[model samples]
Target: MGLLVVAALAGACGYTASARYQPSGATPSSGAAHDPTTDPASATAVALSVAAGAATETYRTDIGNATAAFVADIGTLQEAVDGGDIGAAKSDELAAQAQYDTFRQLEGGNAVNASTLDELATEVAPNGSFAGLHAVERDLWTSGNARADVAGLSVQAPVAQYLLSRDRLTPEAIGTTAVSELGWVVSTALPGREERFSHLDAVDIAAAVGAADQAFAAIEPVGRTVDPDLTTSVAQVFSSLEADVGSLGPPTQVPDAAIPTTLRLSVSQQVDATAAELAQLAARLAPLGTAGAPSS
Candidate 1:
């Protein structure tokens, strides 16, 4: 590849504009370049391109750290249990729950197999009947499903979770994904009590929305410049949805499920509508590379 690039450059070198030299022995036109000039719009486009890369990396780093904390919490809980300290084990497990909320940042983002944690739980773990985190949730929180191997699952599960953001996230993937996730949080994940076993439905929804917030913010600076009205609308939609979800209750509170029906439906509708606008913005800028590439 290096040799090919060098050869290509060598082949194309002579075409570069030269002083007092003209192709076909003709005079240069008035269009001949003056000192390189910057068009504000083109400069914005280039900046947006760079921002896309930075934004994607930010998501990657956030998810990576959250996953690490989650795994460590699990390990700590396991050690507490092995030492026969039930109270301490429970404390660590509770701390792990908080980490789980952060882990949901990957929901609908990547690697979880579904858009939301609830749907992800519907997917069975590799060679196992239990799905994603719910598999571990059952063993830890519910009495009937205790598994001696729950601790071992901590490591394997995070590997999958970590890759979802680390491997799959790119600015390009943020397009409709951010809106789709928010919609799912309000529409599907919340009402169903997605984390029924752990009883973290509210936590999951809040975390999921917060994750989408990061994603939207990542693109917002550039996106706003590219399409002012669309970008403003997108930000407003997200803030409205976030406020609604946050107002639902604290992370520790169980989703009422019944009371929020009216509000949930409203948020869901808004999300669907807003997502279309952001999709247009994403298509316009289109990030800078394929998701599988370096994204710059």
Candidate 2:
């Protein structure tokens, strides 16, 4: 998923609602783009495009708010650590982590630069600089409980703002990204890879699920217009997946091993099912001249 920081650029750059969707290897007609009023596909495409645009704006705002709160919490944590208040530092760190979990998807898909988010909340900086949320988590959890270097760890705000400025808010892009994200949640996050230090993998997993659900919501209405049955199936699968994740219970500080194996397996299976349904949804949206087709 770390690669997402770079991969998302393809979806976030140089996109516009007016672009025509031509199938691969097909040449455009001599006339102007197909008229949405007369073409069913074009009409569906336009509607989905508009919905995606609106969803993008909402995401930008939500992520921006989360980033603001996260930065503030980090500052308070730093202050507490410097003041030798370990309890206060731990509490502040939890607050910061929770805020980041709410909008961590922004780190992957909308970041203007690879290092912009990494420098703030990454587990390990490519440059070997051990800073950011994970660094603080490690320090707080360690026996030493010492202060971590929290200088220059607030670039998340500008990254959130970057989403607002970029225009790649299309149904195809969001759907495709959501499918990939859910795959990661099932394979990596639920397996205890994320939030290893803080034992907060449940929080991260739930956040990813929520983000995927929101992505689906953005496209589902148009999907129903295009294919009602497929949309219903997608919604049903999402409901099951959300229920399985909820079974994990609320976010608490518990080691991955402490979580029951049966429940984890159940959630992982449901996640795969949900991603499959979303991929189908994306496929249905592709031919409507609004979204790109999924790659295989």
Candidate 3:
């Protein structure tokens, strides 16, 4: 990509703006005058808003592409398994595994970022971890009617459990932390690296959102309690993650029948929504100077 494109993308990913406010010795109600020129809190909020927006977009895009690829692989494996073509099914599974490995690389070690979530989604896509699951599904499909069991039930349940855990973190927390980090980085980190804020992209945004969603989803249901508002907010974050992924391609399928259809749909919807929200957020955040205006 050209420098402009790269900068735009970077801005969308997680670029931090310069500090707008400087500490002043003046106290507002005393004889001293408060300097409105440098308001740290406002500057920090603007920086965070931008980071959150960019991260959300990047996460959504990556997830969408990864999910589509995974679904395609699952379909291929299912067809082979249905036709009793074990060799073909295994080959498909292998391909999925390769993709999963690539996904892991994208995740890197930043568990709190959207990139990590993108990696996780790629890892669990039907073609990835779920590839071998088709074998079990095939068996269930071919067996005589014993119960109304679905194929890949056992395999999918665990995957869903994992997903649920990953989506437990609240979006507010993720957004807040990401922006805060960006502010700190810009203020304290090297100036040369500060320019990277202009190069954030959709992929980076999606990755950050994905990581946050995963953290939210991972909360234990027993001891963890989410308020209705928080749940709604988190759900929005999840939607953004799925949306970004969806933008890259089609919905990915889960190989295991044990995974609930409702859960899958819910997640897919969240990803799509999250992607849209993130894009908007990025646009809003990218235009601020070190400290121009407070984000309403």
Task: Compare the candidates by lDDT and give the number of the best one.
Answer: 2
Better of 1 and 3 by TM-score: 1
Report the lDDT tens digits of candidate 2 across residue range 180-275.
879878776898776657776887688778878877886777666656787888899999988888878775655577789999989888999899
Q: Relative to the unseen true structure, what is the C-alpha lDDT of residue 137 in candidate 3, on a scale of 0 to 100?
A: 29
Candidate 1 C-alpha error for residue 141, in Å: 3.8
What candidate 3 gets wrong by more than 4 Å, as runs, is 1-45, 99-150, 153-296
Better of 1 and 2 by lDDT: 2
lDDT of 3 by residue, 1-296 (tens): 34455456435544333355322222322122432212324443334334434444444444345545554665676576567675675555444433332233222333432222222223444654422332332333344321121134223323422332232112332333333322322232212221122111222223434444443342212101212333455456766545644453321232223334454444445544554443333222222222211111
- Runs in model 1 with CA error above 4 Å? 1-41, 79-127, 145-149, 161-169, 256-259, 294-296
Q: Estimate every model's Cα lDDT from 0 to 1.
A: 0.54, 0.62, 0.36
Ranking by TM-score: 2, 1, 3
- In TM-score terms, which candidate is top? 2
The worst-scoring run of ten residues by lDDT in candidate 2 lies at 23-32
Residue 19 displacement (Å), model 2: 6.7
Model 1, range 71-93, lDDT digits (tens) per residue? 78777776766776655664565
Candidate 3: residue 183 Cα off by (Å): 28
